[model samples]
Target: MRKLTAGLFHSIDGVVEAPNLFQFDSFDDDLGALLTGVLGRVDTVLMGRVGYEQWAGYWPNAQVDDDFASFINGVPKHVASDTLTAPLAWQNAQLIEGELLAFVKKLKQAEGGEISAMGGISLVRQLLFAGLLDELTLMTHPVIAGTGRHLFEPGDPTTRLTLVDSQQTAKGNVVSTYARRD
Candidate 1:
């Protein structure tokens, strides 16, 4: 079965909304290497409506030549959205059919490389709560984002996660991997 994993740029205070605002200084060679390794294992990408729209608008027309742009544009993307229609504008992107959890479960059963859920707090929360997410790696920066949406909020159901791996970058970013405890 293909493993479903998620990697988010998180803050020390658990903010996962917009890492671009706070993660610039903490981005180092080690962090870049870690993200590259994650991309190496992922053959498919999953995104929520907001992330899909944001990335579709940028990555397709991005003038810069980079590994991320190439990989994201070339890899197959499954978008979960209730409002978006068929014939997605971005290359290799398609609207997901049927229920989100059901589709993901079926996809996991198929033969493929690792599946990555990228840049969607709501989507990641759904997958994590439904027990569909296999691994979650948070690249936690050393800053406190006093305001913004967070990955985990108050009153959420208790979910146990086991720390499987952890490393720190020279710039003080802590990259930690957690597996859902069953």
Candidate 2:
């Protein structure tokens, strides 16, 4: 089965929105190297509608996401959205219309290496609830947003996870990788 990993940057308080401004220092060369290595092994990266929209506005020309734009542009990305149609701003992108759980389960069986979900709180919430995620890579920042979009919603239930690895960045970010426990 293909692995679905959730890679996110968040606050220690669990707020996972608009983290770059105050958390830029949290990303360092070591962390960059580690992320690069992880991305290299993944066959595909997926994103939600809003996240895709946000990336569409920026990545095609600039690809601020990484020097991996060439790789990202070429890799298959399955997007979950009710409003988006085909012919995304980025190449090799597709739209998942309905029944996310089955669609993702099928995707996991059909083809590809590790598939990753990188953005959007609503979509992540759904996937998490469906128990589709296999691995999680979280970078916990120090600052808290307190009001922006959060990765985990209020009353979100807890799920068991096995801590596979962890590290502390120079800027106080706690980088941890967890695997969903059966």
Candidate 3:
């Protein structure tokens, strides 16, 4: 079975929204290498409607030479959405209908390298709540954004995770990888 790994960019205060506003100072070759390594292992990308719409509007036209742009534009994207229609504007993109959890569970059981969740707070929360996520990787920058969408909210289900690995970049971003305690 394949594992569903989530990759998220977060602020020191756990804000996961608009990372572009805070993550620039810490970006370096080390971060690039980390992103390259993570993206290289995943064959599939999963996200929610909001993230899908936002990404589809931009990534397709991004610089072709960049590793992230190239990978995201070419990789098969699966968006978990109920309102999105077919013939998605983005290449190799498809809408996931029906039950979200069931679809993800089936995908995990199928043959694949790994299913990576790019950045959808709602989707990640659901997957983590359902015990469907296998790993969670956080690239936490050293900034405290007072308010934004956080990865975890009050009344969210509590799932225990084991810290598999962690490292700090030269710019002080902590790259932590956690595995579900199952």
Q: Each model's TM-score, in the order given?
A: 0.98, 0.89, 0.96
Model 1 agreement with the true structure over 1-182: per-residue lDDT tens digits: 99999999989888898788888688999999998988899999999999999999889887657889989999999999999999899999999999999999999999999999985889999999999999999989999988889999889999999999999999999999999998
In order of listing, the candidates' clash counts read: 0, 0, 0
Error of 2 at 24 (Å): 3.0
Candidates 1 and 3 compared: the better one by TM-score is 1
Worst 10 residues of 2 by lDDT: 63-72
- The lDDT leader among the candidates is 1
Between prediction 2 and prediction 3, which has the larger lDDT? Answer: 3
Off by over 4 Å in 2: 63-66
**Candidate 3 error regions (>4 Å):** none
Q: Flag regions of model 1 displaced more than 4 Å.
A: none
Q: Rate the local accuracy (lDDT) of all candidates.
A: 0.93, 0.77, 0.88
Model 1 pairs whose backbones collide: none
Arrange candidates by lDDT, descending: 1, 3, 2
